[model samples]
Target: MAVVCSKGDWFVSSCSSTLVSVNLKQTCEPFVFDCAKAEKRPKETEGNNKSSEGGSKEKDSDRILGFAVSSSGKHIALTDDHKRLVLFCTEPTWQCISTRWVVRRGTSLVFTQAEDEVFVADKSGDVYSFSVLEPQKPGELKLGHVSMLLAVALSPDDKYIITADRDEKIRVSFRQAPYNIQAFCLGHREFVSTLLVPTGHPDWLLSGSGDGTMKIWHYETGRRLQSVDVRQHGILQNSDADTEKRFAVSRIISSPDGRHIAVQCEQFPSVQIFLVNSGIESCLNHAETLALPQAPWDMTFDSQNQLWLLLESEDINVLLYRHSEQHWKLCDTETPELKRVTEALQAQANVYKGSVGLESQFKHLYKVTFDNMASYLQKKQERLEQQSKKRAANSSKHNVGGKKCKKESSPVAQSTS
Candidate 1:
């Protein structure tokens, strides 16, 4: 998974037990830290030993759950499946500032608006907050839910802490005093996978879920303003229960200008775009749909609002699309640095293998054909329309000539009589 920082840097979570950093210019550097080797608190080792004993030498606990970079882009916090929280400083060098162990495995991580504190939501439905200013101290439990927390975020002003759980509920609580519940944005039929607050629109909240819908809400009042069903645009049909459950909306990203929203679903190659405006009844107007070569694993918009899509394929290429002339166009140019990063990730992926390699290659080839077919159909439609217009013009001329001949023949008949 690739996470775009506020400063336009990329943090890639690798399965090779490392985190890679790509700078603004797309230069790749390995920020190596082995959680297995990191020193843990005395009490934390017992749980680690037990988890390792029950699983293979490669425990899932070693994998990273989530990570986030601070607003200043100076610090980063990441959580692993082993309930280990590691904070790093990205300035002079990528150094691990501190390592704090949590009670349960974390599902999501986010830094506060001021970047002074970082919050981690765990599988046990509890939110823990650790002050970045103090690295040695343990994290304090903030708030929790009855169900597993899937996502969390803070309001731009840091007024409220919003959280979502597997039960399809989004809770808004006071940032300072989380016990005082503010509101619950409840409308999702399935687990809420992601939450985002638009840049300029602090009052509005955007959420994507397993229900195949993206909803816009007024976070303060907990009002459901609109819901857009994105399944119609993709191959996932709502009627199929298995398909609906499998193809949930994985990510929803808003443009920097807050005028457009981009949505991606799991295993879907198509990216849906929506327009945001006050008078709009539903944001599902389908402003534009971009067909990607591979299903996107992650996506983000840069400072210039150019959409970047990271494909989940063998090559793992990043595609950039820019809006031009009332349409979204893919730039054919590839930066050398970006190409190098893609090749590096691809090499890393090849180290792990299964029978799916051949199948994925075929899928990529099919996607190319699909794209060409779409272009061919579009041109074919235009040609057909032009031929229809020509036939209509010729028919109108024939009608005018027949009318003139009828009039002349009528005058001749009258004179003979």
Candidate 2:
């Protein structure tokens, strides 16, 4: 199930390459943008032809990779599997602002604090900056990493750009001068999946990883403030449960106020909330562990600071939680706005029910580890044997050739005698 996010009155979600944005205010109809139906722009088509033949494969399957809304909630941007970045304006009404091509498929999208530029991190370990004002302008390369970048986020001050990669590293770089490395938040045993610079806590950075841990850092200096073992917080898994997934943090989001942090594992039915006790020396204090009736496919906190959960079940597809008086209380499921949003997203109910993606999505991301020493020794032995066989064959060929040459010389000598 695609993650659900909200911007002001707009509650947006994506399925496949299609984006569905509904106005909870009920003034605007549920707006849908399907990349499949998008007509090729002459300029974009011409530019596509100019691209090197060594570009991303034409999967013909255009699916939304990730999307983000600006902090002001005035703009929303998304990248699709077809190497296209689409932006939408959410002012008076939802309208397509721009559709541009990225150098490669984007893994994450983030808007700078200025909201004038959108930064896209791709599988090639590079980040690109696209202009929000100049819709027709092409993207410019910002920075590069040695390994594939999984997530990218901007500092609240827009001075630093934080990036996470498949190489199990989080890099903090100067946005204006990317070459000037700020610090490296190291220690995640596995690839990091999400990065967030919490609201109000400008210097603090939170990251969730495949290692099933959440690490907080003083992003500028790269000093780790705290590392939380998320797996340990929840119930112990049975012997047969997958070790990596029982605790891997697939998603971590902070409330707009940055007072609460929500962590979830993919397809897991429980969400853990941690209270941020912010000060000069701040850390995460465990608040509550919520066990849901059905495994939530995705969830997000709205602009109003209310949590919205999209579950795997279709009958009760949505749940809302309001934090009142220091307690999270469940809201009525029969709200009018929720009904409209659900009706617009009814087509994706079956897709959400499909457990294949939910269960196996993060499973493939974890690097499969084996004994490299054993493998190396085995390969070395095979190479030595192959060399020995080649040497024997070469020696036999040389001997045969020598013998034949000697016999021909002997026949010539006998004829001369």
Candidate 3:
């Protein structure tokens, strides 16, 4: 559910409901917020041992399936199974102030950068946008996809909206012109799990499907930029019949720099990093799997370019993967023995093809205990500074408004006196 940057200053929300904040600048407390307690309990606990794809939403009523954070880090949009769209202010605290039920069962929520509009999609494949600034007004647009909406994403420029669905279709539509459907990118043979539009590239869309392949498409040209068969790489293709999952590609993300694309391999417990070349080719081989302490179902990179993996199963371990001295290392809260097992496996050939010297970093096996309390405290201090800046901005605006109001009221008060 949460990924923090390397310096431990910034964080991002994952599949979890609450925001995880860290202050790396201080060493007293690095992480804050209890997302688990904030979530609504699952409907049923029967067969609690059941396993699902890494990113699958738990049966808990409070679990959030799809969410999008604004580029400016000022707002967050989230959706639940009840077709509710909840908007929260990111500064000061994670407060859910705006809530609206768009459909009987909503699937995804996205927002435009320049406008106050927030988009919500449901299982029916229909998309609706309500103004976050004014939720009571009628939604600006209503459009339909060819199939059930699996995921929804707003383009980098917030000009277009793209949706991937069960019918293996990706539909692109304008944000302002809701009645018009721009184009459909059709190629996937199975259900689509995720869709991503890189930060600076609005014309391109990256999609992952149950078909076990990640495809890059040029939305403007309706062309297939490239397609990499994720299943054919590493341990993915070797899945036994007894271990097969119902869906695939739980999550996909384009790195901040837009040079690489990392995709979660369904229930395979691994992540594949591909090189985003001119034609969307994979730079790493089958060994590019970034192995987690457990099967990683949800993941994201922080501002420091560190990998934060969230496990779906009973193993509540949140592992942090950092790059130092030219090799990837793991930072975890597991036992020394368990950490050793992870290091041994990660250092194996089947994990990453091009490298091998990264295991020495694990020899220290740092634990998240009081001894390392300084690391966490440092992170907390940084968050305090960010919060302070937000408060300052609000205070300045309030003071300016107060002065203007006083000036305007002077004439009225003089006449009354």
Q: Write the per-residue lDDT of candidate 1 for residues 332-388, one digit (tens) a residue.
A: 646554465455555555422221223221121111115788889999999999999
Question: What lDDT, from 0 to 1, does candidate 3 have?
Answer: 0.60
On lDDT, the leading prediction is: 2
Error of 3 at 174 (Å): 1.9
At residue 310, give the lDDT of candidate 2.
80
The clash numbers for all candidates, in the given order, read 0, 0, 20
TM-score of 1: 0.75
lDDT of 1 at 304: 72
TM-score of 2: 0.83
Q: How many backbone clashes does candidate 2 have?
A: 0
Top candidate on TM-score is 2
**Predictions in order: lDDT:** 0.74, 0.81, 0.60
Which parts of model 3 have CA positions greater than 4 angstroms off? 1-63, 135-141, 236-247, 279-287, 324-327, 332-417
Model 1 weakest lDDT span, ten residues long: 360-369
Model 3, residue 201: distance off in Å is 3.2
Would you estimate the TM-scores of all the predictions?
Answer: 0.75, 0.83, 0.64
Ranked by lDDT from best down, the candidates are 2, 1, 3
lDDT of 2: 0.81
Off by over 4 Å in 2: 41-58, 235-246, 279-282, 314-316, 347-359, 371-417
